[model samples]
Structure formats: C-alpha cells, structure tokens
Target: MPYTPVNVSLTLTNQQYVALRTVNGTVVLPPGSSGRPDAGGLKGIIVVRQAGNSYLAFERNCPYRPFDACALVSVDRSGLFLRDSCCNSQFNLQGQVIGGPSPFPLRQYSTSLQGSQLNILN
Candidate 1:
C-alpha cells in the first residue's frame, strides 16, 4: 500500500524557519544538509539539501509497512541514511533502499525552490 500525500510550503529564513526538531536535537542545515522538519507528509517531511539550490524532500513513511503506525523513517546516527526502526529498513538521501527488508525506496515528493521558499507536493 502507498501512504497518503500532503502539501508543504516552507520558507527558510533565520527568523522564519531555520532549524528542525529531531531526536538528536534541533538540526540546522546550512546549504547541503539533511534534516527532518515538522512539516507535511504521511508521517513527516525529510528535506535534504543537495549541491547548489537543488533540494530533495521525502516522506518519512516506511514503504515496507505502509499501514503500520511505527513505519517511520529517521536519519540514522551516522547521518548517511534514513532508518525505519519498525522494520529495520534503510534508505539513502536519494530515497534508495540500501538495507533491511524493504523492497521499495522512500516516497519522494516534488519540490520547487524559489528564493528562500520551498513548495512540496505529491
């Protein structure tokens, strides 16, 4: 099964939306960093800053068990991949399944960046 999609419109600014709360603490990504924001999505939103102004947004829902409440992905301790503790599924920043039993990658959302604003949709 697939997860439900949501709309997200966020603006990155020092006083607007600068950091994201996480289990580790508030993460402040400069330009090329990955962080989970309290944004829209089935579970939540994980935003990764690529080279230049390119950005990637993904749903935190683990594809292995779409219906499970615990099927959520988080950035691993190494910060190299997103891990779903419920099923031990792992995915890279590009949403590629790299480990565990997951047969599909993480759900990616279309993102459009304009200046300091980012709009995400399914």
Candidate 2:
C-alpha cells in the first residue's frame, strides 16, 4: 500500500514569531522561541542551521523522555552538541545523545526556507 501523509496547520500570534540569525551557520532557539509550534502544549525549541546549501531544523526536546522537565537542551559556542544543564545530558546537533544518561536522540522537525524565512513544522 502507498503511504499517506498527515497535514496540519498552525497559526501564531505576532508575539510568538521572532526573527533570529544563524551564527557560525547554526542558531539554537529556546523552548519559547518563535519557530516552535505552540499546539497541544508541545514544548520544544527549533534549531535552524545552514547545512551546505540547505537549512535544517531539529527539536530541542530530548527523545529519551521528553516529558522530563530536565530534558530541555542548550547549545554553546562549540557548535557541537546540545546539553541539558539541569541533568548534564548531552546530544549532538543531529539529535544523537553523545553523553550523560539519555538513551535516545532528540526529536526533529521538518523545515523549509523561503526568502530567508524559515518555517519549522512539528
């Protein structure tokens, strides 16, 4: 059988959308940033970066146990991995856990860029 895809639309208020720039080819948005979809209490941030000639997007919530309040991740100047300052869990930019107690990778979101505008999909 052929696979079918699901379609969902999100509408955001002006206060929710914020413009950010990619530093050193990567930009990390915190949980309450603009690119994140605010639906169903889905809590996570989006990472927008330039990969070669394309842009990529990833969810900041660690996949091991997203509900864990401590699963939120942050990136540093190294442009390497996302670290959970609360519990010290570390995950690479690709969402792969590189250290700490995380057993899975971080969740990822689909992304599209048009005229410098990036759209992150949940």
What lDDT tens digits, residue by residue, belong to model 2 across residues 38-106? Answer: 321134454545453355555656555666776667775576667877667787666777898878776
lDDT of 1 by residue, 16-106 (tens): 4443222222222221112344356766777876656667777777889789989888888887778899999988878899999999988
Q: In angstroms, what RMSD does candidate 1 have relative to the true structure?
A: 6.7
Q: What is the TM-score of each candidate against the true structure?
A: 0.78, 0.61
Poorly placed runs, candidate 1 (over 4 Å): 15-38
lDDT score of residue 121 within candidate 1: 80
lDDT of 2: 0.53
